[model samples]
Target: MTVPLAATDFHADLDLALRLADAADEQSLPRFDAADLEVSLKADHSHVTDADLATEQAIRDILHAERPDDGILGEEFGAEGVTSRQWIIDPIDGTANFLRGVPLWGTMIALAVDGVPQVGVVSMPALGRRWWASAGDGSWTATSDGARRLSVSTVDSLDEASVSFQSISQWAQAGKTPELLALAERVWRDRAYGDIFSYMLLAEGRIDMVAEFDVKEYDIAAAVPIVREAGGRMTAFDGTETLSALSALATNGILHDSFLSLFRDLPRA
Candidate 1:
């Protein structure tokens, strides 16, 4: 049966996004923890596999038939329309974890209007969790018990904050490791939460900040709503509306500006 994903209110869209996630989970979860996969390197050497392609195709097919007017930009398929109202999807946000059976992977889908994300959903089926948000009604999450609203932590001081990073190799390759390392040094603590979950935690107020370089639109688009709707700030390291795919910083709103200053001294190499 096809769930229409027809929602009229903010919470309704949240429900629909989650329902879309449920559909996604049904297709992807059974394939996880599989011993054999046709994993291989892409042109840039980032890992990809049959799961990524098949999951994306399933989501794309649903969107195409359900909301034909809406555009879509997927990790596997190229852009499908010329409209500002577009859906950005990363069928599995942490492919590495998915391939390794790490249970840290999740599906990501976002609705971006004129490049601004207004709806976001992240579903980690293996972990049995999901989070979603709309532009106004606020961000939220679901667990085994029930759903709950999310709010960023009130940790006002960077010296007392914990920053969740994406990856060391990602930062090093972007030539921004020095700045990233310095930021880590300034923070009270750091951990590599890599991929969609870090920002989701930021939304839930469990983590104080996150920064990373070398990301695709699909990597962070769905995450923006979860963060912003929770009252955190997400943007380029320098506080721009958007940076090229290589740079981003997300923090509880209070830490954004002061935190960006820590990057002023990133030594060029």
Candidate 2:
């Protein structure tokens, strides 16, 4: 049975997620540039590291103790338990960058009820930044300076939009490269600022839109609420409200329909 969470409960979960992120940062940051770091590849051909396993294990330990009834789906360890309330975790969202000593990676954690994300936390220790949101509690970010509420940009048209699509390869692989390139030509500017950073930038009002392919649920679950609470919109390329979608399209709400229109007739892989 699915028991709904009240606003206070969501806030409490948000706090717990933040604490988990702290532990994640501790486990991941020290390994970022370690001389003895261990790296391996997953079945999907994506990179994974010792830091990823350790950080996810630490988080799983806490969730196992604190919310044993809740289910968990993690990038490194896979899913466990079965419940309407599940914690989705991507211990390290950008392992490729982490391995390269780039600062574009972060830890993503989210609580979803009946498959709807209600609380989210993204911590980028290397970048010294964190962003979070709980349903109805608003989105927020903490930096070296301090914390502040987040909001998406007000850009209302593709002609005035600054967008990030993660990568050209994703579109090419999806058989939508021409469509992506055409959309890029219509937008004010385009960047390949792939990974969770692009969504965080969208939440911070620094970027107007983000669309990507070949992403898993854990890859995006934590970002959905952060974007939604920041006055932005997130949906699959088909315009559905779902985190399970293989592709994602996020924008400052005003531009969602316009953005969706661009891919209306394009073939998606």
Candidate 3:
């Protein structure tokens, strides 16, 4: 499925997103495993680190000077302005993994026009990998040998699919553990390859499906375009095309409906 794009070119915005990711990586990598890394809890009890704050600030600084008129909605600092064009950011998508020295964490950046993501960049400096895409352009990943365009796998059957459910605890908390387990039993394999990496893997054609609960827009915004541009499909679990649903179900375009049918009757958030 094609991602929605305004008449304007997205190349410049996508370039800025890449630069923002670079800045985020610069601010975050040094603090990855540092003994002095400060960690704290938000009111909701989720962990936040000094690196999360600093990295987001670095990205914001650049946006403020480069695209001062665009709005900003960031995980750390909250919303900044109100406009049709907005930059959504999650400086450290997997802060728990980051603070624990796991190499699975990354930075997420996206430019949404009228609430639809048109440009996206996900950077995993710890893993030396980055994936990006703009609406109409194909998804691509930077590689040592140069860059490779991305495409989803051709797995068309649930029994043959490899799925990533993100976290079992999330399903349990959402009261959807039974459904998750049922889906897991049907899939060829199931794993909780949490965070944005799961979506990236799906975009790269290495995984067939990814579903998760209790996610914010920033968590999935930067992934929508990449997945869509890579010939995959992403939407809320209930089959609606939206990021505000607080849940996500992404799959190879061929398997999207089959995956959605599993959770079709559940009440949305």
lDDT of 2 by residue, 172-251 (tens): 99987777877888899999898999999999999999999888999999999999999999998889887877999989
Ranking by lDDT: 3, 2, 1
Model 3 scores worst on lDDT over the 10 consecutive residues at: 1-10
lDDT of 3 by residue, 41-85 (tens): 999999999999999999999999999999999999999897489
Better of 2 and 3 by lDDT: 3
How high is the CA lDDT of each candidate model?
A: 0.82, 0.90, 0.92
Backbone clash tally (model 3): 0
Residue 26, candidate 1: C-alpha displacement in angstroms: 1.1
Instruction: List residue ranges in candidate 1 displaced over 4 A.
Output: 1-13, 265-269
TM-score of each: 0.91, 0.95, 0.96
User: How many Å off is the CA of 205 in candidate 2?
Assistant: 0.8
Residue pairs of candidate 2 with colliding backbone atoms: none
Q: Alpha carbon lDDT of residue 17, candidate 3?
A: 94
